[model samples]
Target chain A: MMAKEISKSNYLQIDPWENLRSLSKARIALGNSGGSLPTREVLSFQEDHAFTKDAIYSDLKEKELLKHLQDFKLPVYQFQTKVSDRKEYLKRPDLGKKLAETSESENGDFDILFILTDGLAADAINERAIPLLKEILPKLNDYKIGLCLVKFGRVAIGDEIAEKLNAKFTAVFIGERPGLSSPKSMGIYTTYEPRSETTDERRNCISNIHENGMSIEKAADLLQYFIKESFRRKISGVKLKASLPNQIDRK
Target chain B: MAYKFTLRGKTYSFKDLKTVLAKATPERSGDALAGIAAEDNKERIAAQYCLSEIPLKAFLDDLLIPYEKDEVTRLIIDDHDTEAFKPISSLTVAEFRDYLLSYEVDGKTLKGLAPGLIPEMVAAVSKIMRNQDLISIASKIEVVTKFRNTIGLKGHFSVRLQPNNPSDDPKGIAASIIDGLMYGCGDAVIGINPATDNPQEVSKLLKQLDDFRQQYEIPTQNCILSHLTTTFEIIDKAPVDLIFQSIGGTEKTNSSFGIDLKLLQEAYEAGKELGRGTIGNQMMYFETGQGSSLSADAHHGVDQQTLEARAYAVARKFDPFLVNTVVGFIGPEYLYDGKQIIRAALEDHFCGKLLGLPMGCDVCYTNHAEADQDDMDSLLTLLGVAGCNYIMGVPGADDIMLNYQSTSFHDAMYLRKVLNKRPAPEFEEWLLKMGIFDDQGNRKELKEQMLKLK
Candidate 1:
């Protein structure tokens, strides 16, 4: 599997950003213990357009998804009116992420908000994003949940909305650009602080979190662990790892 | 039989998935970066990546040496020939998030946000801009066709033209564009180079243009526009902003002008000066009339590398980039010879990199075989590759279109539509959906229409 197509020199370049000296590489020995996993109330690709919202929501209700999201231990009161004409939505993205009318008039002080937006491929979000959200929602209670608004359309919407709502760690679950390899892929753009000016790299993303790749349950646990390590190391992306357990107890 | 793969300077062989895991499992690197790689590991990197390049090695050495814990640095390259990978993304989510949370709001910190937040927003903005720009251009192209098909334009080929009046006539036309709205029709972008050689002429031309715009109430949709060449005007004096304060005719309507880049960069570095986003620039291009030809000399023709210099300098200084290059030329000749120009621009490391609109040489070929006005312009417009202001001539030989100028006005108008916007397939559909002609930019009704490709 490793050597079919790629040549010798090229393959050598693989994972060079990681380490090289360790002669002893680890194999996932038959026993790998479970950390924190999720019981996913999975929704197939066809099930949830009913729950999905768009950049144009006729009337946004704030309290709708909160309770189920509340069980996740994170805040869900925030909702942005991610609605605007396609042109302004593209050019002036800042306006696309204003808080849902009700939330904009009112206020909430939650740090590090999480937004679940259906970017370029709303279909992918409808299929998988909601499931991943359901899985991660309950686990978020351990940390203080900032208010969030799930939007639809392009990813940059999160940048402006993040600034509008001052969040320490703002994460947006937007659809990834559908590669030929996978169209139903999802990614999490987690930034240190939410602002209109945040960029791609500054935000950590966990990609392939849909049916086409990683399982939703694994994605949820992985993200939960990612958050802890991110806060602990204060960094993420290629350099993230769960803290080593003192005891390797197999479940 | 063994299949071998090399990674991070080490070669490993895998007979299959079994041997693949046996050979190259996720080996821990204690050190994520070379700088932290306790001595011996760093030596190996020098041997593999360093190819007779010392400065490259030395540069990497210095970058690696600074890898103390806490600082996140990713890419380093010593090969000047190779693309230089930035170690830090211009902005990272971590830093941006902290900055946002840290922003001050009502005596309380609004997630610690600050002006530094501008960079990431800028990058993200640039990413999605392609879609919007493409839509705008397409709509313009399609819309012009709905009007006159045989269009052309004739304005100053060099100097700007301003009218002779001042106080009473704000929208009057300079002698250069006296034909004004009635001058061009159909699809084209004939630059109104009003031959205002002096400040007074420029002022007069400017006044005339304003007056003409007001008199005709020339909807930006009408095509012919004033491309004010103000660089030759008095730079040491004059209130520039007064002219630029004309974003009113249409919310997106821009009063265009051309400025020397070096001068613009100098002003930007001087301070947070305005006029950075407006008044386009003439970018460098390799244009030497061939068939009706001239030799390739520095002053004569420029490659992409030479052209992108001032703009990059300006962008580095955080100034907005607004310019177009003259990469193409027309005349008695059939095809444009821009081979040398295109090759160098693409190869040059710094120039024309990540630029939004960089046209290849010979942008519009086909010799205008298509007799239809739209066909001639679209074929020629490709040369722009979305860069440089596409200059079009009146298609079909109609001097009345140019309104007495040597070129045709009908062609210019059609080409102007292409230049000023991204031409759409169904312009009427887009306009009606966007409610473009209405007082309110009622794009709300057309939401589904735009997203659906026809």
Candidate 2:
């Protein structure tokens, strides 16, 4: 009698939803082998995780970023927070929120101060900050603007810098927490009359600014709208609800 | 009152009950960040020793947060079941740990004792116990709940198929739901953490999930994890099954989340009035983590773990169907690493189970944290052995929307296979009918099941 022949493909179970992968970037329709994920899918997931980790730990290329910021024709100031390094930054968020005692402050009368910081993901700031600034700076040309970049800083750090500068408003460009799919996403937080004690409810946030999410141009447009409305109403954050054309006159 | 303990000829003193609890907690980064962690291992041990001698009844008398100031504290004090606490009222914290681990205290006994114990008492006993002690005691207590299908029964495992999409796209959510169902997940519920909190957007996503769930006749409920106020606004208009909220331990923390006891009570009554469940009416679903109170600047000099247990006290009051600790989703600032995350997960599960809540874990980690997939595997296995009610089933262990890694559908399958656990009985019968699993409770080949779902 002939020996029985068995096929190795019998063990692999491919889901029909594989075709639906185009609808979203979510990791779905990964075929399985005996109820566990296939080797290729598992390795791909690990690879993405490794990349995300790299993006988080990577430094914000300060020299390159400074060169790009200079092109905006605005004076750039550099500072550091109380956080000494990456390790300390992750462990002590309070330290990241405070300005370092050694860092020099500049007192300026400005309408809006733009502050940039390397938050949880430095690569986000390294890549997207300049592009977003390019889109936003020209729109705010009528107002007096001050630009500054701080290392090892959190979003709230901008409040202290802006407060020292005597700026009427503060717009912060910081790196958001890196997701697996989007490592270079940036966020914009704009606060009116930013003081050291300003809370989160006192700011308006526009998040997920990246190639795949909200484009830089769109984020710039939204930031411009917020600045104009906030300056007009002398308010920001939760109280500054987006007003439609009809609702604008009522407010 | 100040408490002190002499250990190895060195004296460690804590100024108050909150200080003692904070120092007694295991070394996690959150406490250190708050500047309240024990100075050294010896100091931690000293605090634990001092805590062990305190009587269980002292927790009732000496409150952590003053009852007059915090509604959560007042709720705990008002809800104390002195009748039920009669069994273990006289035991010290150390003896309470031993009593819980004793073979004499089984599931039914734990159910009876749950009403008598407060979060602080459970949190204190947990500090003195080892990891195995946490797991072994938690394994004996089963907290069964129901909305459509019963959950937390012994030898039964469940997964809350997340199926989250970044933009809340209907097709993408549907695709993930199908994938999870083919892998024999979604026995708990199909919960979506929507990208937008806009009321219209939330309503659209909730309607989509409800439509798909009703279309397939799946024996499960669906929820949109939006803010509670958003849910309340749309609950009357949409097909709301389980109201979802992210509650914290302290009154201020809940305030930061834009909630209070009155708001929670309103949402609870709104969910109950919906009258959507067929099998049971446990309508509330809550998600919590260790460091929420601290993150909101509301920890009140208390440790994260103790505050986390207090959040469970809030959950138990509403009689939620499912309460999950999204353990490692809070970053390294709170948990630090895999070891801390694992310890927090075990402690949260143990405390919640003892408090008579059906506890699940989102065995997850952010990329920034000093953790990896291996840590998640260890936690998943340990929770499985501890008889955790459910774990999250994200697509391929990566939540693109939330930007974190959680337990996947395959991880749920792995847990069921290794532990010989099956899905909720009603869900398993549906799976059998759908040909996802055989009568022997083993998963079948998925090609046909995929086609059926497609």
Candidate 3:
């Protein structure tokens, strides 16, 4: 039998969906050159991935972040998890959830505590954390608030910090895992009466906060709503339903 | 029972069959994380040697998780084909490996022996064999299934056109579907992983997929990968061709996913009642991966690869049209790098095919994992050679919603061109009629007719 000859084309065949690229960030309408991605598109994808990788390895600007936290006129404290460095933090997630033996802790009675950590993407916390806090700090001014910055921390670290500080609620502002399109996205996890043993089900999360995704103002509003409802119902997470009056219940 | 072997003047003893299986597994990060891996290479080889001498009947005698405690174990024991086991029942694990690689064991013999072999037995043999051995044995075994078109025929390759959107936007999904169709993909299914599990949103996406499929007259099936209960709640009102679920090996892991054998059976019945197939009626699609049970804290001390094999037993019970292992989607903590991902994908395909299930692979990796496009290309090429049933066909190999990179439409075309494979026969014919491909099966330039799909 004779082998079939593979086709070769000199120019790329552009997809008509190129007009629809604005509708979604998905990599659609990629013009092809004989069943393969064009040279420019391939390189463009690689460049975006490079940015994401860099973000994952980037360090949090703790000094700058701490200065920004002081603008709220609340007490600011810094802590570190048990993880020694980034490599260990990525390999052993269990270590990142525990407090370091030497790290200082604060004993304060507060209604809400905000803890910031540079999760998979430090650029997220560095770029958007302050702007979001500015939008949210005033709405929560009627109650006592404390700000804490952690290095090499995971989501569960907030549980331990809240338990130590004796706060009624904990709102964690951590960087999300960087996606190709949205490298500077942060996630907020709010839990009521948080303890070190708290599982993921006990916390309510609002993710994908960035310039390209959810705006800081919208996230602040959602966080405020969750805090008020949690205090009223004495619950959070799976049980605390986000039942806004304007939205219809799909169920 | 205790198993021991003396290798290079050092004696190693495993506490039980589960311990031996875990020790003998290839080096992976999940086993190391679970603290079940051998301390060194010599200990691993000793465990492999000890495992090779154990007879095939030993697995049947000693249950890994115990029949009474785990429904998966009970299913395996109750569904044993004793008569079919007669041919290789007397062979030890080493002998079984040799028997499979022998010249006489062709596709027909393998199919006849499939029901007789358990997941543990196949996983054991796979542990001792090389990557090429897995490929060679799997290429001979053809486990075909059908919904609207046939899959897993000899000299045929298929692609699951995964048009996932971040927010389930209908127009964005439609554009991706048309793009995939223009490249002659989506023969296996046009499946989507919805961002939310709301039944209303799932029903809307299902309706959009069904309408687009009907409008284009594409020879394929459509599925929305959601929780089993969500599908059941909307099965009566939606246009679902295949019921999709992410199944695991143990009862507890399935519980975490909120599913059980009874729920799976119920969903199967619902899909069967719809009668939504033109050629055949195999209407279940399952996605499994290594370390799912471990992630759920329910592995029961078994290795990830062995548990992955047991998941195939669940898929086989329902006779699924398509079953794939999202091999690398479970992060680096499970499969550290490219080498580990490739090994796990080959092992999954080999084990699934040997157990009489139609196995495919997602050929994907997460951004956090230490892998790149080169790794995906290598796995895709190897799976194509191993007679994989289907691979994911995302545009440009980037999944924006899930934030992972998988095989691309161009990767599928490259595999077919290099391996001399064609799409499912019916779908290939549809492509010809639609002017997507010329008579020689070479892709044609984009035509005006193709762009007028809307």
Best by DockQ: 2
Question: Residue by residue across B242-280, what tens digits does model 3's lDDT show?
Answer: 999999999887875667899899889888889999999
Report the lDDT tens digits of candidate 2 across residue range B147-247.
99999999999999999875566777888888889888998999998754556777778888888877778999898997787788888898899999999
Displacement of the residue A248 alpha carbon in candidate 1, Å: 22
Candidate 3 docking classification: acceptable
- Taken over the whole model, the C-alpha lDDT of each candidate is 0.31, 0.87, 0.86
**TM-score of each candidate structure, all chains considered together:** 0.29, 0.93, 0.89
In candidate 1, residue A73 scores what lDDT? 56
* DockQ of each candidate, alpha-carbon based: 0.01, 0.39, 0.30
Ranking by DockQ: 2, 3, 1
Q: Distance (Å) between predicted and true CA of B170, model 2? A: 2.6
Q: Tens-digit lDDT track for model 1 on B1-454?
A: 2334444666543332212211121111111111121134433333222211112122233332123411111111111222222321243322322232232311122112211212212222221222223222222220011111111111111111111211111222222132222222211221332211224444544454445444533322211121222322333343222121001010011111122334334444332332311223221111211111111011112111221231232232222211222222221111212332222222211122222222212222111111122323443444233233223332121111111112123333333344443222232233344332122211122223332211
TM-score for model 2?
0.93
**Residue A250 of model 2, lDDT score:** 8
Please state how well chain A of candidate 3 matches the true chain A, as a TM-score.
0.90
